[model samples]
Target: MSAPLLAIEDLSVTVRTDEGHAQIIDRADLVLRPGSIHGVVGESGCGKSTLIKAVLGLLPRRSTIDRGRILFEGQNLLTLPRESMTREVRGRAIGFIPQDPFQALNPVFRVGDQMMELLRWHGLPGESPPSRGRIDRTTRARHRAHLISMLGAVQLADAEEALERYPHQFSGGQRQRLLIAAALACGPKVILADEPTTALDVTTQLQILKLLRDLAETFGLSMVFVTHDFGVVAQLCDTVTVMYAGQTVESGPVASVLGTALHPYARMLLACHPDRAADLAGIPGAVPSPLAPPSGCRFHPRCPEARDACAAARPATREPAAHHSVACVLHDEPATATATR
Candidate 1:
């Protein structure tokens, strides 16, 4: 319907070191609409985090984009001017909820000050300038009012008191809520949350998910939630992208991906979940290092249905149904294999 809010085509990323560059994200293709929540899931080091980070232009200093494009609202983000990108976009156009608020928030600044600083950088200058140092009293009050309302939007109580307190003063969930408030204050359309609930307790994690759902509905916010937990994706995402090694092995509507998983890697991932029935069991062996992924499917080393051909030819992504895609040859099970096994 609406133009895709974000489109990532054949994205490939690598970490550069003194020795050489090692690619961690390879050939990730994704498309998201204005209000859809797309979840990218995989075990640790599966390059789930790196894919989104590359899109946000928030890659680590050692990282580099070897190939592909990140298109946001139809503009190529990879080639946008860094300073302008950060100012007009990054936090402002697309909000980010990091996995750890402890590391994202500043210990030195008061909660409200941090919000104000972010607001000031790209804020309508005449409307809201530096409020701390001798500005028009009217402008200062307006900014403060906007800030308080934002805190209230996140359902935080005692807005004034919370503002005066530093990040450490708030609980884990509270700090995350504060980050969410800051994110909303920027008037962003999409929120790129990297395992936003990983650091919180189960109860708090659920609450945060509810908050995100509510925020998405109320603000029409599209979201890219990066997580290893399929359960979270089941609850929050409209679609799921299952990654293994450094590439997406499956992508589809959440229900289709979960209920009718086809890729051996996708099936293995679901098996790893304890809640899955015994018939649907855990995958054997640790994920191979990206420095040297297994040949062919990259999952052949552990796939139950892996065939000699699987080890010889990597299956490219193919959609058997309109919304279901898998990158494993089993989908095309040759007449011989279907008859034999």
Candidate 2:
């Protein structure tokens, strides 16, 4: 197989709290292949967004990457200089579609101007430098045309007209489409979408999902789609990584992991889905506090099949099938009978 487009290896992130430093992402590993959408599913506060922020070098001031590397196309992102990352890595190589469309765009400027400014700053092909003196009308027209074409690809109606308006002038879905257009403006190899459809209605959510999938395929883009919804993962992702508190518990091809989840937490997550459960139920117990996560197996406290050995030490990831792995002790011994009571 070809090398992964993006590889997050044994990454750990820590943040400063009132009490002390707390690790939010612990030894998390993810490998995203080119031309595929990988789903990162976990409850809120499970370090989903933290993982993405680490990849983009957008971590908060109080946060620090305590260990491991984030490699994009074999280049270590964590080691790159801040200026180099801002000028070369972000937008040009990797795009981001943040959860809140309203917060993503600046309300003070027209949408068209914002996009053109980004294009010029990134030095996208055909963008002339203002320092070289007055830009010809032809260059300005070409820039506008390029913006309209990108918006049109996102299926925005009256793309040219939409450009002249402010972000607030459009509906929630339209604003999302515009953000997506901006993300694609630089033709990135990877797109990190953090709950991009969480704020929209079900119908709009589906529409956005389809649009993202289409865009990924059209652009040969690799994507890390972070969300709490398994249904969305089932619908759009080719592979899935299920995280808890701060650890990756299960990961594999979507069909293998979803159809036959090996980890107790994975099973519980699938069982709680409305379509799978007779009654709509949620997983019992809240996520463990990141500041004081449970020792050994993070999910042992809530796992129905937890045994005494579970709390003794962290379980090593075991593979029972090709490309499928689960971080649970049940797979450690053949005599250990499975129970989900």
Of the candidates shown, which would achieve the greatest TM-score relative to the real structure?
2
**lDDT by residue for model 2 (1-341), tens:** 56899999999999999998898999999989988899999889899999999999999999989899999999999999997798788977899999998788899999998988767666444343344334457766876888999999999999989989998898899999999999888778899999999989999999999999999888788999999999999999999999999899999999999999999888888887898899887788999888888888888888778887777788888889889998888888754434333
**Distance from true location, Cα of 240 in model 2, Å:** 0.7
Looking at model 2, which ten-residue stretch has the lowest summed lDDT? 125-134
lDDT of 1 by residue, 34-130 (tens): 8899999988988988887887888999887888988898999999999758777887788888899788899998988888777667563223324
Off by over 4 Å in 1: 124-137, 278-281, 333-341
- Which residue pairs collide, candidate 1? none
**What would you estimate as the lDDT of candidate 2?**
0.88
Model 2 quality (TM-score) = 0.94
Off by over 4 Å in 2: 125-138, 334-341
Clashes of each: 0, 0
**Whole-model Cα lDDT per candidate?**
0.82, 0.88
* TM-score of every candidate relative to the true structure: 0.91, 0.94
